[model samples]
Target: MQQGSGSLVELLLSADNFYELVSTIQYLDVIQSRNSEAVSELVSLTDELALTQASLNAQMDEAEAEKQRADEARDEAEEARDQLEAKIAAQAAAEAAARKAAIEAAQRAAELAAQSEQQTPTFTTESGNDATVEVPDLPDPDIVVPDSDKDAFVSEWSARIDAYLAGSPLAGQGTTFAEAAWEYGCDPRLSPAISTVESSTGRVCFLPHNAWGWGSSSWSSWEEAIWAHVAGLAAGYGGQLTYAGAQKYCPPNADAWYASVLANMLSI
Candidate 1:
């Protein structure tokens, strides 16, 4: 009976061991299932990370391209600005040079006039006799003469003179002639009319600036010549247009010269 009881106990212990083994096997199965799920999750996370990294790389490339374009635009703008500034500088330099040249020309004209004034001039009469004349102190050509009728005379005769002298070498010399005539108390039309007869309004002259065919005189400028001629008329011809004056002016062809000069004067 005791042996039988020991056999039964052994069987019970074996049964318990079998039950424990079965439980351990169930736990191991659960652990394996959990491990499989974790590995799958890791793979999914790796794929997502790769996709995000690619997107970031694409954005960075686009940003770099944009920056390069901006830089190129800025460089082009600067180049254009530099070119514009160069053009402006060149224009300013040219204007300054032109102004300087004009000033120099005016100075040269003044100097020549002063030199001519220092020398005594000779006038040839109708009889071909040379007469020495003292030059009077003349007013500055740059300054306007203060006479009541000066403006009216200049306004009327200058326009007429300019109209007649249009397309000629002496085109712009109307104001000079008018002013000189008013200053020296000479007939405004006399010298210009004589010029039309003698030198075709200064187109053909025997000497420089001697449009009136006056005494082989050469002048540096038209202004000086106009002033001197008007002054000479005032001193010699009594500053009037007369038959006797015309006879004295051109003894060789007095009648024709007088008629031509009168016709021109009337036209002006």
Candidate 2:
């Protein structure tokens, strides 16, 4: 009883009380360790969240960059399309203008041709003699020819022959040809047409103005040649074309010469 009555501070200092105090301290330390582990876990979770946010930001940046590239590509494509359309429009406009110009030119040309047809220009004979002949209007096909118009007819024939041989050596011999034809009762076109066939209208022949290719013959002048040939045709072949006459004239190539001469005569 005296021991139990001892001081309470001494009782607390005893081994059993001390063991209980140590146990309580250990439990408090365990609780603090668990709290520290929880704090570390929270820190790790926060770090992971931060990493995930960073990754999401990077993905968003990449997506935005891709969108910018796509937009640029679309803009470029639109620009190209617009350019192509503009070029096509320009080409179409050019073709339309060309067509319009051609139509206008054709209309103008037709108008000019009509005007020219309405106006009959005078043709003056440039043969040896200068004669101003009035170009008659379209003649009446039913009009009968009077004997008095013979000289006028011959003059017209002369003009036609002269025009036909405008650039030839026998150009100015139309009047001579007509006179010779009248004198010999020969076709006016015969001698000259023969000359055209044989010598290209006296351009090439066997010598000095020998246009008719008449038998190794040469003449002093075109007039001498013309008279001689016309007289020969009148005397030799009756101033007419026949196959027999052609054979007599050019024995070697009669058929060819005859056909060619007939064709030339038709042209005249």
Candidate 3:
């Protein structure tokens, strides 16, 4: 393949933008072989020069052999030293380049791994309400009535439906309304059941784990919603709010009423 830019060595040697240097090292071995051939060629050239000097000496007499030997020795030593030094320098440069490339690749890998960890989102849930941790699907976006709100239960449930569809942040802000309702002496089940009564099968504003239409219930931020339900009931659910003497004010089926209100709280 054609190299897009500089020499293979230059591209492979860069520390910050290097890859494939190891594979290219084998190519260096080939270059070393070529360097060896260069040494052979230089030796042959020296021999040819010596033969020329010897031929020139054939035109002279006596101590000519000694003179030629001395001159040839000096040239041979200098030339051999130059070639050895140049070969060593080239090898050292290539090795340094390869090592720098490897180190940069490793550092890049580490940086990418760190970035991956930072990018991944971590889910979080408030404490004490395990249901929030494993909430199922969110309910439908809108809950419509069955062409009427004439029934007493339907009308009462309808009021809370507005709050649920509003996606009130009070409960989701931190507190499970159940704890709030329980603390304020209102049945926790009442909220979720209001949702069911208004929007059966989670069709109306199907929020998950929020039966009370509160989305999330917490007394800390949603003290008003909690107190509202309490005060609303205290104003007299069917003329009297007190739980005592409940038999007189409540319909004949008190157990069934709370059941239909917050079915999820039936176990509670």
Candidate 4:
């Protein structure tokens, strides 16, 4: 019919539409084929869309699982950091306490030492004698006497000298001479023997009880002369009986003086 105007069913029914019917039927067949191809393409597209949706769901599940694991790991790390910080805080507190204690102990020790230096300590002896001796600052004594007073063998020699001087001016004075000789550390017989040679056993003298003929020597008493002569003999002539000592005592008549002194000593 007219180019493309009427329906195919209406064109088929007309006497002038014979060619139109043929053309229309052919067009209908072609349209039916295109519809079948469109339907097949639509089915393929629907199947691909379903498969993509499943894959997206699976990726979402995997992402959710990874996020959960990351959260758990973050929680564990936080717990470890908290425990470490707690330990550090505890150690710092303990160290601070120790330093404070050490400083306090040092301060106490310094105080005790200062107190001890200021105080004078009292010393106690073991014998239970509690006499508090107040020792004053005094000058030293001039002489220190010995605790013991001994005879020095003077008593026996004094008795012998007394027996020899029976009736002389120096009677009963033998012990005095012996004491003086003991003090001077000389032979007790040396003085009496020298007296016999110089003054005939002290019966005669130049002056004032000078029994020995010592040069310008005198005394207020026989006791004084005895001490002076014995001290001189010890200091000058020495303690031993020798020819040299005899010469030193009597240089002018050493031989006669020595002989006479020795003879008198033998008699005693």
Task: Report lDDT per candidate.
Answer: 0.67, 0.63, 0.41, 0.63
lDDT of 1 by residue, 113-198 (tens): 56888543333433243322222121111112325778898998899989988887778889998998898877777778777767
Ten contiguous residues minimizing lDDT sum, candidate 3: 127-136
- Displacement of residue 112 (Cα, Å) in model 3 is 1.3
Alpha carbon deviation, residue 192, candidate 1 (Å): 0.7
**Candidate 2 Cα outliers beyond 4 Å, as residue runs:** 1-150
TM-score of 4: 0.43
Query: Which residue pairs collide, candidate 2?
Result: none
- Give lDDT tens digits, candidate 4, residues 91-177: 757544533443343344445656888532111211111111111122111111112233645667688889888798887778887
- Residue 235 shift from truth in candidate 2, angstroms: 0.8
Alpha carbon lDDT of residue 24, candidate 1?
A: 51
Model 3 bad stretches (over 4 Å): 1-62, 118-268
Best by TM-score: 1
Please give the RMSD of candidate 2 to the true structure. Answer: 28.4
lDDT of 3 by residue, 85-138 (tens): 999898767544533443343344445656887532211111111111111121
Of models 1 and 3, which has the larger TM-score? 1
Better of 3 and 4 by lDDT: 4
**Per-prediction TM-score to the true structure, in the order listed:** 0.45, 0.44, 0.21, 0.43
- The sequence of per-residue lDDT tens digits that candidate 2 reaches over residues 1-268 is 1135445455434436656667655755887799999999999999999999999999999999999999999999999999999999987676445434433433444456568885422111111111112111221111112234558757976786787778998998888877676667666677787776677777777667877778768888877787888788878987765555666776654444444455455455
Residue pairs clashing, model 4: none
